[model samples]
Target: MSSIKWPKKRLKRIVRCKYGDSLSKENREKGDVNVYGSNGVVGSHNKSISFGKTIIIGRKGSSGSVHFSENSCFPIDTTFFVDKTTTKADIKYLFYLLGLLELDKMNSDSAVPGLNREHAYSKEVLSPSYTEQKIIAKYLDKTCASIDTIISIKQKQLELLEALKKSIIHKAVTQGLEDSVEMKDSGVEWLGKIPRHWKAVKLKRISKIQSGLTLGKQYSGNLVKRSYLRVANVQDGYLDLQDVSTISLPKKTAAGLELKKGDVLMTEGGDLDKLGRGFLWEGQIEKCLHQNHIFAIRPIKSKLMAAFLTLITTSSYGRIYFEATGKKTTNLASTNASKIKAFPIPLPSKKEQGEIVDFLNKKTTQIEKLKKNIIKQIETLELYRKSIVHECVTGKRRITDNDLKE
Candidate 1:
């Protein structure tokens, strides 16, 4: 460790307002900065606290997050305030140091996690001289800000790439590759035109769609023996068999609705976004059937590739159609076989369909790889930030003039 010295018992103070009497938006007047829990800035108020240049800590709901403001501010019941001590400790340094501390670890494990003010006040914090503290804080502020800016730019780039992928999928499914080629009017309103050779057909004309068995009505005590698929098992573009639940269905029902490879599974009722979400079943699970809220789509193979059609149905174009036809309640949207059958699909020749699937497989594989790389970068940045905070606050790494110059 670099030679940096500070007194062991640095003086610090903790102050907090009484519960129930804390500031509120209604009671707070104009010109006051209102501070809430860890989330910060719930509302503004006119009343101001007497203390200036203080650090605030979230006391309940969201504990551990620290905030620093220049002037007077009112903290609500869910938070506590800490002003400067008379010792040589720097307030700004303390603010950043407190942020590095994971105070949520100290919370009581009740229905709503809470932090005791007295317990938090007694916690120890390492501190250097006020002058050195300011220098270290300034160095961190500048360096971390640059790193944060770069991370934000990378995040935005990732988002743009994702949007581009979505746009490509939407365009490919809605309109054929060649715009200027001869186009024929499709009978379906949504499907404006298709390649002259292609046709528009109802989903029902090309596939069999049916809901699964109802839940709770069937239950098997042994999850391993009777592992049945649930709505959770069917993700938007993939199947997650990790947490398959078991259900005891009658022997006849199991035989009637047994899932087969190549069958497309879809969710029937849920959030608007997930209403018609589906994936293809590629696993070999004997006696496995879908739950009540899922729909199984069995495609008629001549004109459709199971993978390609599933992708189109789960893409943005399909979402638009499903949303348009689904009946919306308070929190759920649903569609029946009739509505599903009426939905239009643009049908291409078997050769063209196969080519499109091959093209998508190549393109989507690259996109998925890029996404994984970006996710890894994000995780690395988070770990680096945590490491920096831990080393700096613990005096394991010391800030020097050379570091500041860099």
Candidate 2:
């Protein structure tokens, strides 16, 4: 810690934030110059907006976000560009200092969020000597880079965990736990092989695909209100249930739509990967009706278990089937009840199904626990990175050429 009293100065006196020029898709010529938006590099262009190293501040959209470019780049209309020529302070030091200001909070109240430059200019910052500024920046450049590397490693661990979970589920559902069992070709392309005793059956043969009630329908007679699950409430492998909304419907209609325990809930549309992705609903909420966009697959007690079917539907086999059968647009894909009813399910005896479900449940739980621990580690590293940058830039932690040696 240093006892030096750094001079306080208005932000405008330390650096000038120049308005970035608009470069639309139609006009941009492809080159090495990075085209910067408010957040970061968005595209490439032939011409450079600023020479050498520069700091880009988000002016609109991702308002107030800070990005550093080591090379000459074009900052688009949605950003503010600053370079060595615009600041008396070391440009690198200014980048770290501006990040600590929380300029994102100074965004104007509008339909589209935007940062007001005047509000940013009015804020005060501690001004250190130019020499100290470079030292702090150099130290931070090293420190933050180290933190980022750790974060990246943790992120890769999370990815591997997810891939492991998916792999386990796919193998368990498609190939039975008994390795010695005789195998046969499952006619379904995605579902390549299965045990000899197992039979490939359409989902509708073993379960009923129940379509939910439509919203905004004008109903006659007395209206009864009940909580309903929408597409948003049903996530890939679990129900969010945090903000269950209510809808008004006739008591008869509401009763028919009420969710039963052991129903597999799946969304009808969204991103291609999200289509047909869902988990089994265990009657978490009583008297809950679901929207038309969500399909509740009620498995026949005699033939299917919701948990077992849920595993099959969430596996790679299900993903491939849904993507192949689903109607596609540019970015969105959807499946109707007819398509869902035709979903191929590997049918084993009740005993085998229960055993598979139990095995998968234990495996997935362990994977999820590992994922949570890794996520927490990443969050901690990010927080520490932010705190250290703030302290060094504000002179709370003084760095010198000698400190760099340590």
Candidate 3:
């Protein structure tokens, strides 16, 4: 086995500056990349800084994220700037190496997580020759770029599949399976057609929509250790119990508004695209109560499957209805009880509805599995990129320009 060694040295000669007093109104202008502190480029400014080919390390908020810019730019006070004199390190090699470091692990917990430059510079680093450094950085740039391209293609494929799934659901619910089936005019303006025997009815006809309980500030103190469901618990099409919180509420309140199995929960307001995100309650938690930001839809009949309604409400057709009726406030919009109740639904026979739900369950499950596999492939590619960078930068692996030619 071949062994490679990295020399240990003090990064003593590097010039460092904490991002502060670097911007003046005279020097600053709009449209230039404004180097933010921890949160990244929060805004843009025309002002430039003295650091050339340097690495900017976020000190607070987003500690340890390293950004390398070839041109002059302003660095915010929450960031630490490193210039060319920083040891004998190759700027590109160090940038790539820093990318591999999980800097979040080093954050000091105070009012906000932060990094101290003195402590950061004192940390140990493996060093290789400048020529070897360039070779490794160049190889990584090319290889990872290629891998990223493939991942991008796969991601687009996933998006296309999602669109196709929505199209299928929209057609199945609105037009039914039989292409030759006679279409009756849907009385509603947005709904163009319905199966000959199907009825078009308002959502109010089949379900009662009510917002969840508004736990007052006093209720915050009485939170119990039992599982509590909040707006975050409700995801796009399902409930995520991974980070469920425990809050205490009066037993009466819990019993009065507690969620049950087969209940459909929807977000009252959120990002415009997520305003009406709804999901079926699979009964993951016992005696769970929802926050006021969620709405519970209780069906009138056992024939109305919560899962089928949830699918319809989250479908493209449902999203259009939600967007049309939702009241916009800034970036968020909400669908009130009246609007939700007035929303139109295409009613098919209970048997046909069950068949459609079963068919979609099988198809969507397969698509979701494929999506998960593609996501894993993207993660593996990222790990491989990091490994290649580590090995090449540490001299364990070597790449030459001639290798690139081959």
Measured by lDDT, the strongest candidate is: 2
Taking the tens digit of each residue's C-alpha lDDT, what string does model 3 give over 1-406? 0124657543433334355444544555776665555665656686656356767778877888888777666777777766664446677677787776666567776778887666665656666667667767677778877888998998998898888888888888778777899989989777788888988888788887756767555564454545667887887666778987666676666686778887788887777787666788867788887777788887766456676687778677788888887899866787777787787888887888888888888888888888889889888987887787777656676666675653
Global local distance difference test of model 3: 0.73
Scored by lDDT, model 2 comes in at 0.89
Could you tally the backbone clashes for each prediction? Answer: 6, 0, 6
Candidate 2 shows a clash count of 0
TM-score of 1: 0.77
Q: Give the TM-score of candidate 3.
A: 0.84
Q: Over all chains combined, what TM-score does candidate 2 have?
A: 0.93
Better of 2 and 3 by lDDT: 2
Query: Where is model 1 poorest over a 10-residue stretch in terms of lDDT?
Result: 10-19
Residue 367 CA displacement from its true place in model 1, Å: 1.3
Q: What RMSD, rounded to one decimal, does every model reach?
A: 4.7, 2.1, 4.0
Query: What lDDT tens digits, residue by residue, belong to model 2 across residues 128-173?
Result: 8888888888899999999999999999999999999999999888
**For residue 394, what is the lDDT in candidate 2?**
74
- lDDT for position 123 in model 3: 57
lDDT of 3 at 76: 73
My TM-score estimates for the predictions, one after another, are 0.77, 0.93, 0.84
Please report how far candidate 3 places residue 222 from its true position, in Å. 15
lDDT of 1 by residue, 327-349 (tens): 99987899877787787888887
